[model samples]
Structures are given as C-alpha cells and as structure tokens.
Target: MENPSYWAVVPASVRYDKKLRANAKLLYAEITALCNKQGYCSASNEYFAGLYDLSKKTIGELISQLARCGYVRLDIVRDERQVVVERRIWCAIESPFLPADPPPKNQGTSPENSGDPPPKNREYIKENKTSINNTPLPPTGAGIFAAYAGEHAGLLEALQGFEEMRKAKRKPMTDRARGMLLRRLQDLAPNDPAMQVRILDQSTFKCWLTVFPLDTDKPAAPNPQNDRRQVTNGWID
Candidate 1:
C-alpha cells in the first residue's frame, strides 16, 4: 500500500480575484509537499524564504501576491525570540474556492432494533461490545481536514480549526491573541511539511506562536482563554 501522499491538489489554483486565475505545477507541488510535512509552516517571510529555497525579498513578494489573491494568510507577532511566527493554511485552494458543500458526516444507524453485535473493526465500538451505540468517531485533526481533500489538506484544515479554538474563541479576542493552538494542532497533526507553510501562511500555530499553555485548574483541553490570546494577538494576523 502507498504511504499517505505528501502531494496532490497540485498546480495551485492562484486566484487574483473571484474571477481571475493561474497555475504553477512544480512550484505548487514543492509548496504542497512542504506544507504536507510540517516544518515549513509559518507566516514569517524569513522562515518561508529558508524553506522554499527563495530569498527574503522573493518570499515577501510571493506572500504579497498570494495574500492579495487570498491564496495565503500572514499572521505576525514579536515574541521573546523576536521572530515572527507565520501560521500558513491553504488558501491554496482558491481561498474559499470550493463550494461550501462539505461532504456530509456519516450517520450510523441505531443498534437498538438491529441488536446485532458491533463490528470488531469499527472505531466507535469496543472489541467486546454487544452492539454499536451510534457513537461517532471523535473529532480529530485528520478527520477535520479530510472533509476537504487529502489527509494533508485535512491536516491543514485542522490547523485552521485549531487556530479558531486556540486563538479565536478568547474573550475580547482582538487581533492580538495568537496562542499555542496551532502548535498543539501541529503536534496533533504532523502529516506534512507543506502543511507548515499553509498553516503558517493562514492559521499558523508553530511558526512563531506564543502559547501560554493552559493551567491545571481548567478543563482537560481546549482552553478558550489561550485560544483567545492567540487569535486576538495575531493568531492569524
């Protein structure tokens, strides 16, 4: 069996506007592959420059062009390292290009009537369960991104969600609350290096993230406060 593809949805569909368009195959593939990996994900021009083998000036121009077209996002911040962390996510897909018709989630039938034992291979059912309780698969980074395209792309989308929960949902979440949501998201979904760029460019969590991490008193996970911090303070600036 083939390993998860590190590339696909190639020849980035660069949209200058709702109507205008263009394509770049190899460059697109390289960027996609890098995004798929995980390291190159950042909004910082410097980071992107190093990853794509381009100069800072060139990286800046590319970012400007992509942003104008909505194919990339740039979040900026100055942390202790003083390095700007860029969380790029895929606008590479025309930045809302695809119709919002996401594939529907699976709705398993109830087992109360069927009474048959649950399949051993299914995730929701325990190995010794008598029947499926209609439990759904837990929300996972891979699952979230899978709603869009490939595993890598789903990973990218998951980054966006991570940004939302990690940064966007904070109280008074102004454009100054970038947190560790994206980094945690990256940690959870390390399927692609190209994913780093996409996440950094759009919803970067690891590039130059400033995470406060949650305290012990809070819920087990999904710290809204930290997320708010990241989102308000340039989580996706």
Candidate 2:
C-alpha cells in the first residue's frame, strides 16, 4: 500500500473558535498553506467560491468575518482608477515556532567571551511569547467611509443621510456589505467629483448595499413655478 501524505496541522484555536464557521475554518487552512509557501495568498473570491461550491458573496462574507476575527489580514491593492486590482491575504495568527530576528554581532559578548565560542541565543525559544489572539482589528466599514469623506466633503452629507436612513429602517451594515458598496462606488466614479455627486443625488437611501451608476443627463430640478400654479389653482395648501 502507498504511504499516506503528510497531514496539514490545524491550530486548536482556529478549530475551536465558536464564532468561526466551519467553512471559514476550512478556507483559513487552505489560505494558511498558500501564505506559508509564498508569504501571502492571492486567491480570488471566485476561485474560492468555485472550489467550495459556495456563492461569491458567501465567500466574501466569510473572508470578511475571518478578518474581523483576526485570523487573516486582507490587503486590497487598488489601481489609480480606484479599482481593486488584487487582494493579498496574510495569516494573522502568529506561529509558535517563528524565529526571532538575530541579535547584532558583538553586542552581548564580553572580551573574554569573544575568544570563546559565543553562546547560542535561545531567548525566543525560551520565551515563546506568541499570542494567537493578539491580532488587531481589520479595516472596517466606518473607517473606510470616514476616509472617503475626509477626501470628499460632498459625500459627507449624503453618506450621513444614508446612515440615518439605514438606522430608521433598522438595517445594519456589515463589514462585507460596506466594503462591497465602497468598491462599487469607486468603480463607478473613481476620482470624478461631479460624477460622484450625481450618483449620490440620484441614489435612494433604501438598499444602501447596492450601487448603481448615475443615469445619463442631469437629474431634473423641482419646478417651483408648478407648485405656485397649483397653489393658485387651489390644488393644495
């Protein structure tokens, strides 16, 4: 009989994270292997969805959740046009056996010890201070939206209005949904201030997650003359 292949090890913390879904854990392991080999994982959402027979949105949600939970960090690379060109995924969990940076030569050695063979630096191994859950918070929706608003004052009121609408409707925005909407907005307008203004003007507060391009031709202005005519004709107060 053929020998069994070497098994991949899953961290106990990852396997036991109650907040982590089974699919996410499996994806994490796959991504961990890729990161270990190449220092990062560059798999697309479509690739993961097809591999696991899940929808692309589900994959995105899982990845976002994993990032929020500190199992991974996603570095989204955008082109000058503000389109996402690549996603570089990194394993955030620290490895127990990770080697520390080597100490500078002659720093710790005395003159008497210089003549003798220097003792091996075993501090890292002895200390082993790796903490798996010490991961920082991933980039969040509020953070990204705040950044956009900082660059574009025109978006501030519109975005705040959108937030109020969501609050009134009791619809909470998830990090994944927020990221998707931000990317879609960027893809639609890039750095065009006028186009972004038009898009926001035409946008309805409902369904904040979906972004649609602005229609051709400018939005029609409200006719104050028509309202006056209606009042004069006793149509309404």
Candidate 3:
C-alpha cells in the first residue's frame, strides 16, 4: 500500500459538479490521499470499502461515477491469461496538496517522512485492521491451500466464505494462520469435502472462531475397530 498523503484535495470543478454524488466527492479526496507516489491510486474496492465502512459494490459504483464525471480515469491491467493484475485510478487533475516535487518512493518509515508507527494497543490495531485484512496471502501458502481444494468447487467456495467471514469479524487470518486452520479442518473432516463445507459454513453462520461437527454427523475416530464417535449437539467433549 502506498503511503497516504497527509492531506487531500477537492478541486472546484469536482466540488461543484452537480453530476456527482455527495459521497463521491468525499471519495475523490480519499483518492488524492492514496495517490501518494504513483500519481494514481491502486487500492482495491475491498480496501476502500473497509476504510469507509461501505460495501465493495458501493465503492465500485462511486468510482464509476467519478470516472463518468471526468474527475478520474480507471485503468485495468490484466495478465496474459486475462486475470486482472491491477486496478489503477488516475486523477484527471493534479491536486495542489501534493508536493511540487514528490518525495522518493518507498520511504514510508524514513524519519523525515515517517509513515504510521508500530502498533501499540487495541486502538491502534483497530485503526490498521483494514490494511491488515487486505494484505495478500503469501503465494506459497495460498498455492498449498488451493492445491488442497483442487477442483472441488464447493470447497473453494467454502474457503472464500471463510476468508470473508474472518474479515467481517475483524479477525483476518495470516496465510500461515489460515494454513493451520486448513490443517485443523482436515483433521476434523479427513477426506470428506461435504463435512468440511458443513464445518466451515457452521462456523461462519455462528460467528465462531473454531469449527465443530454438525449434530447429525459422526466424526471418524481412531480405534482398533475403526469406530465412529458421536458429536452430540455439535459440541466436542
């Protein structure tokens, strides 16, 4: 993430434009702040949604309106396989709030231009949750999880739901943490994809931090006779 500008700008044209929504003007200011070094903001809709306490769908609409009104330009870059690699929003007009000559890039923690300090307490944690929630999963860890899910559409969907649930609960998991979660789920369900989905869905629905077997399902247990153990009331004893 780029270091946000200390200030924002809303030019007269954008401020007075009757075609834009009131909140869209506010979004324009946010765009300026995020344009710190690249002359464009590359934040994802999810990032903006978390920052403004709005939905990604809503952010997309607002950005579209801004583009339509000539206040910003949207650029979408895709890889050879047609997978989107980046989304950039360029300001149509530069803001006076920006430095005449931009500072060197990637100097986020330099003393003269020190960005956010290290996290200290609950307040600071809450303040930075949005950024943390949007951090990309490490490629190796993510690939392992994807390999585990393979071509099982239901399992893949469950994984995405689990991630969204964590973000919504403000307890986003790191790639390593979620890898541990997947291992735990594997232990609980073994080779049953249906059971895995149920466990994940149950946790998401109940907003629980841990997974549990459904009341109707009996988890396979290690025994001389290969017996199954009953999970009464969906709670493990």
Candidate 4:
C-alpha cells in the first residue's frame, strides 16, 4: 500500500518573495516537502532535476540562490568512502511551517505551573513521529535510468544510439528535452520499465523523440512498411 503524502509547508513571505525567480519559489516548496523533522532534506540534485523537469545544473543554481536569500542552508555530507551522499538542507527561516522539536520526556509540568495533566494525544504524537521518521526518500535521476538500463539492454542501446545520432548531427539534447523524455517514459510505463524501453526504441527508429501509446494490435515489427497500406491513390482522387 502507498503511504500518505506529507504536506510541504511554505511560508507566505518566502512564497511571495519578489526577488526570487518563479523556479526558485517552486523549488523551495519541493525542498520543504522532503525535509525531515530537523529541516534536513537529503534529496540530491538529480532527484530535484527529475521531479522539477529541470537540469541538475539548474537545480544546483536554484538551491544556491535560495541559500543566498537566507531561506536554506546547504550542507554537503560525505560518507566514510569520502563520497558525497546527501545534500543536507536546513530551513534557515524560523517560520511556523518548520517542524517543532520534540519535547523532552522528563519535562513534566511543575506545581508552579498548576500541575496540569499532559495533553491526551500520545497516540497522535507517536503516529506523527513514525510517519516523519519512516518516510522514504526519492531515488536520484541517474538511479532511475540505471535501473531501466539494467533490465532492458535493447532499449538502452536504442537510447544510446539515438543520443549518438543527435550528437553526430550537432543537435545536443537540452536538459529540458531530457526531462520531457523521462516524464513521457514514466507516464507511458509507470508500472513496466521494460515497456518504456520498447516505446523509446520504437520512437527512436521512427526518428521521433515523442512517445505515444503503442498499437498493441499491430505486429511489433521494426519496419513501418510491414503494415498493409490502403489504396490511397484512387481514394483521395
């Protein structure tokens, strides 16, 4: 079963910042959604690129912009292998939107404070804590493509070939274009990665970048001419 989605709270002041670009505003919301209780979001640039239809470079730029504007503090965390594993995001703005720190267990109400009973929401607190702590992070964009490549060799070859052709023609694929391709692949084959490769292969063969629903009724042949052509010469006349 799918987990319930959490809300990414954006402060009105930050949301309506006139100085920041529209992309920066949107990126802030995305980052906020992924942040944990400590305002540390561990998502990578590739993840943001895949989610926002932007290039990894663009995501990096936007994050830097947000940092400069005093919205977030970016910390690069490296693993024991000395490889950067996470981009720790700290929300610098002290807004109500930020998650509150959990209170200490031993801090009970004192007699001076009227000895009021603790709020009767222990279950709710436990549930919220579990949800926040156990929430799964999104995979990086390179991870997504790597997974597809591992399972579908033919499709991977087709994509590589297409990229090579584009490069040979001096038509480099833009970040936006790559994002669009990934989006389409996800849309067309959300459940089946292999099917996405097939679609990509078919599209590439036709010298087309756009993907459409496959005609399952038709034979899965490479040549478009294999399909019977109607006598259009007399019909059009």
- Cα RMSD to the true fold for all candidates: 20.6, 14.4, 15.7, 18.2
- True-vs-predicted CA distance for residue 177, candidate 3, Å: 22
**How does each model score on lDDT?**
0.37, 0.59, 0.65, 0.59
Reference-based TM-score of each model: 0.28, 0.44, 0.43, 0.43
lDDT of 1 by residue, 24-70 (tens): 33333334343321112233344445655667566555555655765
Model 2 worst lDDT window (10 residues): 124-133
Model 3 poorest 10 in a row by lDDT: 116-125
Per-residue CA lDDT of model 2 for 1-237, tens digit only, reads: 222122233578889999999999988876654442223566667567776789867887888888899877777665443534456776666553221122235757763343221234233223322221123234456655644543345675666566556666687677666666667777888766667666765664434435587656558888999999999999965
lDDT tens per residue, model 4, 1-237: 233255566788788899888898888876766655444576667667877678867887888898899888876644332223445677776544453232234546452232221345222322333232343443244433433343244655655666655666676576556556667766777746678767877766666656777767368665434332333333321
lDDT of 4: 0.59
* Candidate 1 wrong stretches, greater than 4 Å: 1-5, 15-28, 36-40, 43-53, 77-83, 86-89, 92-237
The Cα error of candidate 1 at residue 92, in Å, is: 4.9
Model 2 residue runs over 4 Å out of place are 1-9, 36-38, 96-237
- lDDT measured at residue 165 in model 2 versus the true structure, 0 to 100: 63
Write the residue-wise lDDT of candidate 3 on 1-237 in tens digits.
344434677899999999899889999988776663435666777677887888866887899899887888877654332223456677777454332233355765563453222224223223322232242433353454454564355876887788778889998878677767777887888767889999999888888776777756876566633223435335443
**Comparing 2 and 3 on lDDT, the stronger one:** 3
Off by over 4 Å in 3: 1-5, 97-237
